[model samples]
Target: MPLLAGAATVVAVVGAVLALADVDSPLRGPFTLFFLLAAPSVAIAAALRGLDPFGRLLASVAGAITVDMLVAQGMLAVHRWSVRGGIAAVTALSSVLLLLVVVRRLRGRTASRRTS
Candidate 1:
C-alpha cells in the first residue's frame, strides 16, 4: 500500500509539474494522485480488513475508470495525446499490485494452516 501510494505521489507530482509548465499532460496533480492512491489503497484496505474480494475489485475498477475519465478530460483540455495509454498503464499496474498482495496473504494463510 505504501508503495502504491508512493508511486501515485510521484505520478501526481509529475503531472502537476507538467500542468504548471503548460505542457501536454493527461491529468492534473491532485486527480492523478487521488486516483492512483485511492484505488490500490481502497483495495488493500478492503482485503486486509475483511471486505469481500468482489467488492474490492469492483471498487478498484470503478475508481480506475473515474480517474481515466478525469485524465482524459484534462488531456483534452490541453490538446495532448489521448489519455488512454496512461490510464491503462496506471490501472494495470495497480491491479497487479493488488493481486499480488491478495495472493501473498492467501499463501501465508495456507502455509500457516499447513504448519498447524
Candidate 2:
C-alpha cells in the first residue's frame, strides 16, 4: 500500500513539474492527465472510509471529474484560464481535501482515546 501511494505521489509531482515548467516532452500530457484524475480521486477516497471499496472508487472518480470541471469553468469565468493555473488550483484543492481527511481522522483517534 505504501509503495503504491509513493508511486502515485511521484507520478503526480512529476506531472505537475512538467506542466509548470512548460516542458515539451512526450510524457507531459499523459502524466498531467493522470495527475489531474488521481489527485482528487485519492483525496476523496481517503475521506470516504466507510463505503465499500468499489463504491468508494466510483464515487471518488466521479468527484474528481466534477472537481476538474468546476475548476476549469471557474477559471474560464474569471478570464484567467491557463494550464499552470488550472494545475495549481487543482493541486491546492486536492491538498486541502486530503488535509481535512487527515485532521478528521486524527481528531477521531484522540476523542476515542479520551473516552477509552
Candidate 3:
C-alpha cells in the first residue's frame, strides 16, 4: 500500500512538473492525465472513508471527472481556457478538499480524546 502511494506521488509530481514546465516528452500527456484524474479521486476518497472500497472508488472517480468538467466549463465561460490554468485550478480545488478532510479528521480525533 505504501509503495503504491509512493509511486502515485512520484507520478503525480512528475506530471504536474512536466505539464507546468511545458515539457516536450511523450510521458507528459499520459502522466498529466493521470495526475488530473488521480488528484481529485484520492481527495474525494479520503473524505468518504465510511463507504465500502468499491463504492468509494466508483463515486470518487465520477466526482473527479465532474470536477474536471466544472473547471473546464468555468474557464471557458470566462474565456480564459488554457491547459495550465485548468490544471492549476483542479490542483487548487483538490488540495482544498483534501485539506478540509484532514482538518475534519483532526477535529474528530481531538473531540474523541476530550470525551475519553
How much lDDT does candidate 1 score?
Answer: 0.63
How would you order the candidates by TM-score, starting with the best? 3, 2, 1
Q: Hey, what RMSD does candidate 2 come out at?
A: 1.1
Which candidate ranks first by TM-score, i.e. highest? Answer: 3
Q: Give the runs in model 1 whose Cα sits over 4 Å from its true position.
A: 1-33, 40-81
Task: Say which prediction, candidate 1 or candidate 2, comes out ahead on TM-score.
Answer: 2
Report the C-alpha lDDT of model 2 over 1-116, residue by residue, as the tens digit: 99998998898889999999999999999999999999999999999999999999999999999999999999999999999999999999999999999999999999999999
Cα distance off (Å), candidate 1, residue 56: 19
| TM-score per model over all chains | 0.39, 0.95, 0.97
Badly placed stretches (over 4 Å) of model 3 are none
lDDT of 1 by residue, 13-55 (tens): 5664554455655566566556555655555554555557777
Between candidates 1 and 3, the lDDT winner: 3
lDDT of 3 at 67: 99
Clashing pairs in 2: none
CA-lDDT, candidates in order: 0.63, 0.96, 0.97
True-vs-predicted CA distance for residue 10, candidate 2, Å: 1.7
